[model samples]
Target chain A: MNNHVFRPLYLALAIVALVFLARYLLVPKDFGAHERGYMYGWHRKGNENEWKAVTVKYKTSAYCKECHDDKVAGISSSSHRFIACENCHGPALGHPEDPMKLNVDTRRELCLRCHAFLPYPSSGRSAIRGIDPEVHYPGKQCSMCHNPHNPRIPTSRS
Target chain B: MNRREFLKNSITVIAGLAVPLSALEFINPKELLADKPGGEKVRWIFLVDTQKCVGCGLCVMACKAENELPYDADVSRTWVERYVVTRDGNTLIDSPKEGRDGYTSQKITMGDGTSRNVRPEDIEKAFFVPKLCNQCENPACVQVCPLGATYQTQDGVVLVDRKMCMGCGYCIMACPYAARFFHPVYRTAEKCTFCYHRITKGMKTACVDACSFDARRIGNLRDPNDPVTKTIMSGRIGVLREEYGTKPQVYYLGLSREVK
Candidate 1:
């Protein structure tokens, strides 16, 4: 019942009341709208405009067909129809406008990426004809025997 | 005590109780904004056909390129782990450059400072296991995050709210898969988002698109027509570290017992 003891306790209670009042006014009504659990609105403070939106960089193969109809037609009808041009050619960042010739990787290793036979059990989805790069053509580049865009050998080019 | 003093004490106690009780009522906001009224809730699932993966490392490179993560061991968003078990009870595990560079048959130095040449024929069995955030339905990262910076979407994708994250590193420690990491540049805890940006826009993830062997696929588990749905229902699928009880959305087709 001492006045001195009650003074500091009253001030502490008043400060706590003010803090709650400030939180009530400041926190968004739908602070934890997207989340579920006890600490839902823990991120509501100081995160109003926080999402970092990214632009799409790796576009679909359909994007390439718009400009190069001839190449698209060639690839579409060939044995390599499922393969996207960018897969072999890399990302098409700056193309016809910049007039930069995309590096046509003619290395045998490029073709062997998919065609090299692995000893593991195939899932039947990836049971495409694979060859040992060493025995198939000693030092010959894959492009020398098979066209990259069409991928069929000269015997099956038609 | 006098009646006047007794009444004053009762008033003080009533006021103290009312203040905190009223404050608790204001804490939880009402559901003013309803999430799209009748939109179907999407349940995403990622499938990995381990047999189809030829250790090509294209998916690893594609994930790095798409996320714009630096080409560093500690910073990779996703990586491929090659497990080579030899006939003589020797198991070799390596993920050079986080498997960003395709693996080659070469001499690998062991922990004992001894070198061994690994040839294709000498090994009893070898397989490539690609690893990324499991995006668990019951994600520990989401649960342990001190700040609600990490959350799982209704569609089952776990994401990090970069701005909200306090870089506490608690979520990184909580994750059983070792998927989450403190990003060096952003200084925020970062992990695989299941390509949430692309998946929401009806596009396959960068890894799925880049894989030529159909090694990886993602689809709506609710849609019966999706081929991936059939693969999930029928295939002998297994998840990584199911004992942790995370209930990961990602499933592997030919998961061997050796893979952790």
Candidate 2:
């Protein structure tokens, strides 16, 4: 092909590549103010059009203590209370709206939902450890073998 | 200013900053942002005297409150597994059929192996083991993480990074004592961190502080005056699964021959 004929095509290709790169360079991550989809910015879901885009303001475990003084204080004294509620339970949209109504049928199901695969800030394992949901924990719930509140798992060694 | 010059300058600046920023995010990441304190670690461990556990189930309460677990027919996060190991070292575990809250019932087991009821006296010659996270020195959960999810702290406390954890249950199986439990919403593997956040911040573990008989103890194994170590060193302490080699930091003092 003639150099003159091919010059415009070459320029067009370069412009397209540059535009793609520029878009990648300019776009910041788009996350909602109330809700966080995944691990990095996990939070409760809220109206996308209703609220402005802002960093999700995570409430502390203590914030939960304000209304749940007894439960929070109990949790504070308990070993598991050290962990925030949302940390274990996920960022619930409105837990305080009706805490009593909140239900996780299987004891292990709630915990294993996160801890079995996803870990805390100081995890001891990886992201995807490949645990079979159905067969892994059978009739015996997680508490049968371990305790959420206790730092030590109970045993019959002695 | 020319467009080419602006693009070149901005790209160079952003590229330089992005690499450093991402690196920092990975290095000093926040475990929790809400009312959280510095995560600098001090040593943490749990010491249980099986002889002291009376099966009252206070640690169970501690677990429920701490983890905010729901109740009913499901399993309790930290339930007391009470049973009598036979003369042959075979265990016969007997737990309350009811979840956390249940009425006192009679001892009646269906011969067909369905649901049964048992009174306190029916549990003859029984010992209770309150199991939770072992907080091992070499945790398999931390080793097997695919996304750098669960990690060990500087002071040797093992815990999950819920944000990083994908809720895969490999850590649950890797744990020989079945110490790990899954989080319901976050969908990650979790277990006892020896109350890592609190213990490191000058607070007692939930179960330890709540225990009436002092059955649960937390202390630095390295400390000479640490009562937990002294108690274990003084008495014949038994570490579970000396064969699995998880190097569990939890030590059991006063192991009975029946349990062996």
Candidate 3:
């Protein structure tokens, strides 16, 4: 009787241990150290959720950049390069957690974080006193005015 | 449904009643040739008025300080280009590093015993034009992104999906402004974010903050009350290179010759 009880308990413990081991090895690491973590952790007035660095892992751009340096090199040369890889794409903390759960890049409202109508580093223009991107880039892609890799377009006008 | 589910459904229903007006807040490289033009928020445009600028270098200093971009000889997202058109039908170009740490000026002979730092005005017509991502409405960079790292936002903000970027150079050639700046450390493309991070946080852009001249006036074209809207309403605001029909939003009160 004692052996039977011990065997079942041992099996359960073993199963639980295996599960945790699988998670530790198979799951990706979370957003370790980056600007995105700071943003998710501190910014945004009302959002109060624990910072899960690697929740949406597959779609995260940072995750993509790990193996896609060649593609990222061109962007680094462009105006869009200064920002963090995850800023525009949303929280990429999960993608590393598991490769399969990741989907595509989700940029619903993050794109206007920069690359607005007025030239950046503008001399006579105020970056954000009253400008609104929703009103400006409505129903369109921001690429209309800029090229990510090379920015020397002669001009963008009527 | 269980009582818990019913209660949750009722709460949601009640929440729907509270939808007030204040409610909504709401790439790159590939094979060394990809184009990441933008992201979800459409990229906007930037207009430079060479005619009005005096080459103060205030914008340059402001950008570096605001963004906290480390000092590097190889990288410059925003810099000023001074062009001097001499009286003898000759033009001289002078570009300065975007920094307060120091700057460089190359001396050149303009004409009859006239030597200057190749300033914008020494040639004949003097003017300084700032350059960055044009944030075109129809960016060529987007077309070339193999990994689709470059993208534009709904509000016309061109952005790069840094993660998706493959560090390609195709989009670099596609752009006409030479705005895309490759990061030395990350080896990714970069440039001015329009201080988007700041702008979204209700702060002015880095360069705009640096400029005390009131040259950079960022406002909504849709809002008639805003200064930009008022300026357009008041008089003629010029958008450079009209032939492309990119529908750029950045307007110039006093622009120099066409962007070539």
Candidate 4:
């Protein structure tokens, strides 16, 4: 062909090369249309590892059983067997090392979450024993009269 | 050949090559192109017993503590709503502080000026329904994310890529359940992940562990011995917004007709 055809072809090839080079530089190395789908699957493979590496803040009661078998056994035998120790004591992710102690939430509001009477017969909440907070010891703390570990047995003040 | 005919044929060949080459550049050849997103070894499912929920906000508090969210912030990853139906067939709904504080009063203030006390005798029914991210099989949040910041894991949990997210609100608006919210601190779109960090370590989600009433449970569908899986297989279950067809993984037991 003459120089006329060759000129246009060379210009097109140069533009294509420029676009490809820009894309290589702009797009992240880890970016991909993953196995999920082409339309919505764009993601960085490194993100999965980041998410998996996130620190877990809450530990189940099983973790507490290792050291505090007495408290674990006490709760397991009581009506509060299902309750995890961390629920009332706060998250024990960094216990005995950093803080050395867990704060026990003895607030009346904490206990009232389950004990407050709603009178909803349809709801299974009524199945659990509830007391009328208004009439049942207005200002006194529940822990003063009742031991949380074994709620059935009232705490005997020494 | 004529210059025009030669030019047209050459352009066609170049265009065909360009399309596939660009596509190949974006798609990694080494990655397995599976028909499904996750493997068959694990499929996580969440079950909520609405009957057992007592409007206790422990789960909300636990989620905040576990996720390191601002405790005083209005937005939360999970919340509980109270629904009260009167004998007159009027439905009333309220979620005071997202039920972060348990419902202290039986009285609900009217839209006007007055407050009506929902006594057991006057009210036909009252119940609490906890709400959280559905972690849908076909997630709308993932579909609408412009940057693909939101994605579902192989085990069926949906997570946000905080580094990838550019604080765009597209996924927040696209969510049918209003499960996603802008993080007050990070300023990125955030939602529930079913405690992916804890779950992968063989521990319960913070919310599930906080629920002393046995209101929430998570299970793997692949495990025959999983209690939550057994309950799902044998019990009557329901999901919210079935019309949306998001195929939400969270199932509700004893779901009332009034709940949305």
Candidate 5:
């Protein structure tokens, strides 16, 4: 082969070699090891652990059941059995330790969220007794009249 | 051989050899890790019962608290939408504050460019639909991510790598469900992970646990005995935006055509 043909071949070979070198240096080691798809499953496996390690702020009612057995027992038999303790009270991740207290959400909106009458007859919400905030004791707090632990029974204010 | 013929043959050989060689180098078989312990695989699926949802906004609040998202912010990892259909055959949908404060009003915008409180008599039907990440099997967000920041886990949850996400907003635009959002603090792309941190620990997702009604649930498809799996298999459930072919894992029971 003449110098022209060999020179072009050498140049092409050099370009290919450099491209491979760049890919080796730039591409992550774990890429495409377990991932399947054009570009979907490809990710750093370590990132999965990073997400798994995240601290959960909300605790289940079972956590509350440990300390407040009476309160939990009262709720379990009531209409609010499905509601978690942390839902009404603030997140109890560090309660009784660092904060030593979980603030009881006394905002009227908190009670009214499920209590306020929405005229959705087709919804299961209609099953729950709903009240019109305007006509039904407009300024009074719900806790003053109804005990949340067992809403079926009314609690008189002291 | 002629110079032209020789050059063509050389190009073909090089092209074929380069691709396969690089692919072999990129995939190291020995380093691949098992997806889960005990070699057991899990296929996570979500189920939402619209019939049971009352738009109470408890799930929304729980999601915010559990994820440590801003309390007063308008953004949420999950939210409830209210759909109201009037007597005039006009459908009105409103989710004020993303149903975070619960729906107190029936105020809806009319088709004729007017917004007003909808009287109870004027409305024919209304319901609440909770929205969250669908965690698609063929995710468009994953394909559009330039840095491979968004990925699907072995259990079918799609999570964003905040460290890798450069806040490009590509994934947010790519998501047909409008699931992706910019985190207020991290400023990175964020979406529901099926509460991976909680679910992997054998606990219910925060929203699911917070629900007073049995509205939201998570099930593993790999397990036949799973109650959520049984409901998904036997119940008349449907997914959102099926035409997009994203294969959304979130199943909705009593899904009506009125829901967009």
Candidate 6:
């Protein structure tokens, strides 16, 4: 064998060995141990702390039932049963302990958030019986005629 | 051996060695993770009923509050685009601040730098389309990520490994939906995760929970009992940018042809 050819071949072999050596030492021992993928260990490593830091900012509707059982019972039987209390009042982060006062948003805009009719075509079940905010009520509030919890007012015809 | 024969033999040996090295790169962690004793395999799918969406932007607000994403246009994980197609075959699309403040009838500036007043009767048709990371079966973002920082989980959710991310922004460029963004605070690539924390804990996503109209839904596609599966089976659902062949999990119902 020619010395020049053997020399370059040996150099290549040495470089390959060095690269493997570096990889073995520098890479984490648990790297790819889970067989999740190339990025599994990386994902776990990155998100472990994040998972721990996740604070429960929004509590379930059951949380509100503990204190406001009466209010819960009133709303549960109404058409708004699916609607969470926090959905309208905002996130009750420190309500029980700090007693964070929540605003009773009675503004027409607040009521119209879900009640306002969209002009676009929609299914009968999904469609909200929307009213022209200006024309329907004129100057009176919606709550004056219809209850916030149960909006369906009994008509004289019925 | 002749010079040509020697050269061919050398090339053959090199190519043989290269094949296995490249193959090793394709060893997915999710497959291994699935093999664990207590592992639960979940296939997540997001469904959007466009007919039910009233453009209230509550989903956008919910996502922001849930993810604690900064109030920056460049960092929104999800947003809503309002499309108004006029009688003259002109379409106007606008999404102000990712529809965070909710949409009101306003004068919209068109793509051609022309301002038009969008009235109720003047428009032929209008609808709101919510946008988010599709969590594609074959994601371009994951493919372009150089450091293996982005990966899909066994549940089929695409997520970025923040610790491993070098913030090269290649994934951002590769994403056709413009879903990925560089988080100014984290200084790394960030996008929607389908509310991984909430979903893993057996809870609905913030957007799904907030939507009063039942527009947005998330369910396990593998589960036969899931209601969303029924919706998928019956509805004329569509995925955005189907031509790209991303095979996105997010399904849309009542998607207008004018929708991009």
DockQ winner: 5
lDDT tens digits by residue: candidate 1, A17-115: 999999888656555645444533234423422322454556667777888778889888776887667666766655655437666667777666567
Candidate 1 residue pairs that clash: none
What is the TM-score of each predicted model, taking all chains together? 0.76, 0.50, 0.48, 0.84, 0.84, 0.75
Please count the clashing residue pairs in each candidate, in the order shown: 0, 68, 132, 0, 0, 6
The runs of at least 3 residues in candidate 3 whose Cα sits more than 4 Å from the true structure, single-residue gaps closed, are: A1-158, B1-52, B98-123
True contacts kept of each: 0.21, 0.00, 0.00, 0.55, 0.79, 0.19
Name the weakest run of 10 consecutive residues (lDDT summed) in model 3 chain B: B25-34
Per-residue alpha-carbon lDDT of candidate 4 for residues B1-260, written as tens digits (9 for 90 to 100): 99999999999999888886543332111121122434555677889999888877889989998988999998889999888898889898877667787765676656575667777886788888989998877788898888878887766678888988998799999889999999999999999988888888787888998888888988887676778877877788888887676777788999988988
lDDT (10s digit) by residue, model 5, range B72-97? 98789899988888899977787666
Q: CA lDDT, every prediction?
A: 0.71, 0.52, 0.49, 0.81, 0.83, 0.73
Q: Can you list each candidate's DockQ?
A: 0.18, 0.02, 0.02, 0.41, 0.54, 0.22
lDDT of 4 at B22: 41
Candidate 1 chain A, which ten residues in sequence have the lowest lDDT sum? A43-52
In candidate 6, what are the lDDT values of residues A1-158, reduced to their tens digit? 78998998999999999999998987655444233455332344445336425655556577788999999888777787877776777766677775568666566666665566655543322266677666676666666767778767633332
User: What is the alpha-carbon interface RMSD for each candidate?
Assistant: 3.6, 16.3, 15.3, 1.6, 1.2, 3.5
Model 1 alpha-carbon drift over 4 Å, by segment: A21-30, A33-35, A39-52, A77-80, A93-146, A152-158, B1-40, B72-74, B106-115
Q: Lowest lDDT 10-mer window, candidate 2 chain A?
A: A118-127
Give stretches of model 6 more than 4 Å off: A1-29, A33-53, A77-79, A98-112, A115-118, A122-147, A151-158, B1-40, B72-74, B109-115
Ranking by lDDT: 5, 4, 6, 1, 2, 3
Per-residue alpha-carbon lDDT of model 3 for A31-149, expressed as tens digits? 12222222111122111121111122113244458877786787777554644343333334335563334343333233332223222232222232222555765665544564534
Task: Report the candidate with higher lDDT, 1 versus 4.
Answer: 4
Candidate 2 lDDT tens digits, B1-260: 89999999999999888886543331111122112255323445567776556554546655555555544424454555544433444445555631132111223223356644333334444455666666666566666666555656545566565655677777777778776777655556756656554564555665665555667788765554667656655666666665565566777765544442
lDDT of 2 at B18: 83
Model 3, span B43-157: residue lDDT tens = 2334445444434454664465444456555457677665555567666655635423211223433435565654333344444566666565556665565654565544444
Candidate 4: which pairs clash? Answer: none
**Poorly placed runs, candidate 2 (over 4 Å):** A1-158, B1-41, B73-77, B85-90, B97-124, B257-260
CAPRI quality level assigned to candidate 4 from its DockQ score: acceptable
Candidate 6 has a DockQ of 0.22
